[model samples]
Target chain A: MRIAFAGNPNSGKTTMYNALTGRSEKVGNWGGVTVGSKEYPIKEEYTGGKEVVAVDLPGAYSMSPFTPEEGITSEYVRTANPDAIVNIVDATNLSRSLFFTTQLLELGIPVVVALNKSDINEKEGTKIDVKKLSEKLKCPVFETTSTEGKGLKDVISNAIELVGGGQSAPYVQADINLQNKAEVDAEDRKRFSFVNDIVANVEKREMLSSETTKSDKLDGVLTNPIAGILVFAAVMWAVFWVSQAWLGPLVADWLVGWIETFQEWVAGKLENSPAILSALLADGIVGGVGAVVGFLPLVMVMYFLIALLEDCGYMARVSAVMDPIFKRVGLSGKSVIPVVIGTGCGIPAIMACRTIRDERERRATSMLATFIPCGAKIPVIALFAGAFFAGAGWVSTLSYFFGLLLIFLGALLIKYITGYKYRKSFFIMELPKWKMPSLKFAFKSMMERAKAYIIKAATIILICNTVVQIMQTFDWHFNVVEEGAENTSILASIASPFAILLIPLGFGVWQLAAAAITGFIAKENVVGTLAVVYGLTAFIDVDELEMTGGANNVAMATGLTSVTALAYLFFNLYTPPCFAAIGAMNSEMKSRAWLWGAIGLQLGTGYTVAFLIHQFGTLFTEGHFGNAFIPGLIAVAIMATAVILIGRKTRAHFDEKYRLHRDGKSGAAA
Target chain B: MLLNAEPGKTYTVKEINTDDEEMNSFLFRLGCYVGEPITLISKKKKSCIVAIKDGRYNLDELLSSAIIV
Candidate 1:
């Protein structure tokens, strides 16, 4: 049996689903966090040994969808014909939630209204007669606090009993022409009146929602036009500083020490084996995977902070504060959510774009959000910042700020290229009540992500590193390349061509080019491949390296100046994201043209930015342009000319199309 | 005149004036319709926060302007 969990956004459905199924799907305070539906077998404790599946659908306000994600919910409930519907309704907002409840009842599906967030209502001195509400709606009602797992067992047991049973709706709309807008509106008004009548009878409140409250006062400062922006910047800066500069490295140092010990143990255990076997097993597999895993502390700490922010209900306000500014770039404040989420990862960030109502805005957001350097890129940033800049905090800070600059520039370029004029774009977001962020929830979220990180290291990173090790070890003739003749290996030969193209951006050696190439598979490979190729066991041990002359050893191995290093870092940061993220972009944009154009834009931005940074940095420091300056100039000029030419053509096309529309309007008037 | 309305005051929704039918219906489903008591919780230069049917929502100027009170 499949029991579908459906309701309003942020009503704690996913939390309940996670509890019932023991799956850690994303849950945030803001609306539309879960853009897609998911299903899992109910935990044995909840199902009592019965084979049951729980389907968690995206939230929808009404049967008629407003956004694409909402459509998923309404369509699934209408067609899938689940055995029962567990409508997770916000108890505090029963007046609006029941409007959908009544519609669900009309479908003859057995619905057990999970009155979620009743705890919040109780705190506010709001009382709801659950028995009376159940009586009126003709369904079982269980008051639940999904965050705490309260009343879940009762809700599930009652829902299990209702399976295959009949549900009779107490109030039903009179037969009418549903296709007619006026008829639909009239019926919806009657339905609202029905819900209102029931609410007035069963509910009493000491504090009205409209009245000014303590939270509103907090919002006055946090959502203020100017102050809010500054606070947001400060908050983001603090998150990065604490994770990257302060707490992250402390934890990482301890972890890396363990990894180095393990590598030594493996090397000792395989001392009698073939020379190649020890290098492959101990150095290639363990060292490469260990290098990637060393950054887990940084990523996990960042996740914990973001989870707390999400749980506290500040995400909505962040969007509210950034909305006006985002709108100027032809995107909405809602776009900010994805960009912020992109800081952690790009796949879900692209999925978050489903909440935006405007198609163009949604596509543009997905295209540009990846510019915000995700968790996987943190290792690259840290490696470069430590090796080249003495681990200065400004290096990480500057990367983020430069990323924001690129997003803005990318949005404007896209706006012109698409020729989208001002339309009547309106923004509305439900402001969830603020509360103390749950520390336990944040810790759980962090642990879950850490598990995923380790699993990835053991599987994909392990395989890729092993392959990279072997490819660099042998020539095309299957003979191990002679020492000091590494350039003849297959890996070096294939990467040399791409290296030629990257000379304008500095650091154009085949090894650097190979790392950048594998980066398309996963961003962490940039760090992992470098560790394997350079034979460095620990990039995080930079202070020790500086002491033992290993810092210059690494600089000699990679052959990058400070300027070229920064340029290479930015190039990897802004380039088209990993293939998994590209798949997400394809799914969300659902347009081949938009997906290709997005890739083109990313490639161009990465190349142009890296080229300028390298050449300019060299000019200022050494009083001359970098190598291959003329060829780089020609490449940049060709891209700029292509953009200009495309912009003119798009403008002309829009002019002709709109001119025809205007002529038609005036012709009709005449 | 929602955009020009005083904050912390309740007013009846007179009408929804917009060319976008989907947005109009979306708002209506949220209980912001004719005769519904909508309260202006706060106002900003470009947007305003409003309360409708036990929910607080921030609306942009273009949207609030279309909601006559």
Candidate 2:
């Protein structure tokens, strides 16, 4: 049997898919789009055992084929003709969820409605006549809680039975062309009204109960300008506390133990220059790759916490709190989801921007999501914190703020400086009334995400690491360290030109600079580069040199207070994203022009910000020294002036919605 | 106006399938679809936020272009 799962964003469809499929699914894209799909096998023994293939198409509101995701789903439903489609709908928000259902019905596929988040509706004092909705849609409806595993078997079993029954398939016109689509849709409010009336007849509710009321009360205060900001601050503080206090020490200790046992075991077995020891132990495995592996704990812990908040629905609140702030900066709150998700991974973050319907806003959001310090870069921040600065959280925080600054700068530049622009897009979304989160779901999501990160590292990053090691280990003519370090190491030569770029950042010395260079490939590789660069015993134990009293060690050492450490962090956070993100942008924007446009903006932004920082900090600190900082300072000023002037010229044109009156523009009314 | 109609008063969107073309570009796109009752959820600082089915959408002063509460 072939079954496709479809739903709106956050309708608990993914949660349900994961719950039912367990670890049997693979997450990937369809053909070209960056949107991820989950596919798994479903087998049942009835009379005789046979297997079913279930594909979880990307979550989308309508099969309009407006976006790549919707297009892929529409194609699947129409052509592949899945044996059945389980349309997962959020019970609490039936109106919005039903919009998709209405369209799905027209597709004429054998539909089964998984009425998810039923408790959310019940708590809100609402009751849905599932029988009626099922009758109206002409399908079986199962009121379910995907997270709780309630009604899962019934939902899928009925789906399988229906397929087995050989029910005559409903015929839906594959493509209902909307010629003069905009005008026709505009004229068809009654069509939408027809569905609305159907919902009114099928659903009834009183006022929300205490649990629902409490969540609203919390949202009321949590969304209040002053209170919400405070709440946001508290939330960030919690994340920091967990990251610094919990993850830092726990990971360091564990890695130390793992490295010690392995290091000694290797030392005992290998001779001075055993080929295996020289290549896999030292170069291929330990040198660069081990550094990346060491930071896996940090990445996993941070992602786990982020994923938990997202599933529990608190992440939406965080984005809401920032709406007012974002709007003022010419960004919508929806764009913030991608930026927030960006802290976990850029690829998904870029994909997440699919919800932004406006082309300009989506593009802008895509441009900036990479600016957020995705988890891969965490080890870089921590490395700088440990090596140069005395493990100060301030460096980490400054880097984060720099990430924000670059996003803000990119938005401003796009809004004013060029033809690239966005008409103000509204921030609209369902705020699922909060419920007590399930720890089981959170842990499962965490493990799944951490596993994806590890697998990608093993496949993609390992290949790159081997190539880099081979090149660096070779002395041009022959392999110096081992046969593994052949004359083709791509990294060492790549790291050469960047030394010129890093000169002003203090520790631009090639080895240190090489670590930063590797950062652009995958943030995880920076830690690996450092381990190999200095021949450090373990990735986390760089502080072993701190005990030495020599001026050179201390001078060369970087701990929290060093401005250079902060400066390096700034560059990494603000710089252009790696090739994977660039590839994602290429696909999403669907144009080489837009792809290059985004990359150019990132480079321009990074160079400008880093240049300003180094020049100004030097001017302030070590006395406005010689020719060191002046030219860079002037170049920075000119670039800044150009961006500002361009932005001002376009500001007036963009503000058709708001006219500037002496003080401020007359913005949209309350 | 249903005595329930006041500028800031919250109303559950009861069957709002209106033939309002001018509104579609702004009001409708912001999750203000029919039966997804929106409350004048809040009037913070400068504008109001609306609650619509599992979500809350913020609309500023220019909502005058589409909504007439």
Best by DockQ: 1
Write one digit per residue (lDDT tens) for candidate 1, span A396-468.
Answer: 8888878888888888888888787657889999999886899988999999989988898888888888888
Docking class of 1: high
Cα displacement (angstroms), candidate 1, residue A548, comes to 6.6
Candidate 2 residue-wise lDDT, A442-524, digit = tens: 56656776787777678656766666555566656655644444224445556657765566554455655776677778877
Cα deviation at A602, candidate 2, in Å, is 2.0
Segments of candidate 2 deviating more than 4 angstroms = A23-37, A43-48, A60-80, A121-133, A164-212, A272-280, A419-424, A456-470, A479-494, A539-561, A630-670, B1-38, B51-65
Q: Output the number of the lDDT-best candidate.
A: 1
Residue A78, candidate 1: Cα error in Å is 0.3
User: Can you give the lDDT of residue A51 in candidate 2?
Assistant: 76
Give the top-scoring candidate (TM-score): 1
Span of ten consecutive residues with least summed lDDT in model 1 chain B: B42-51
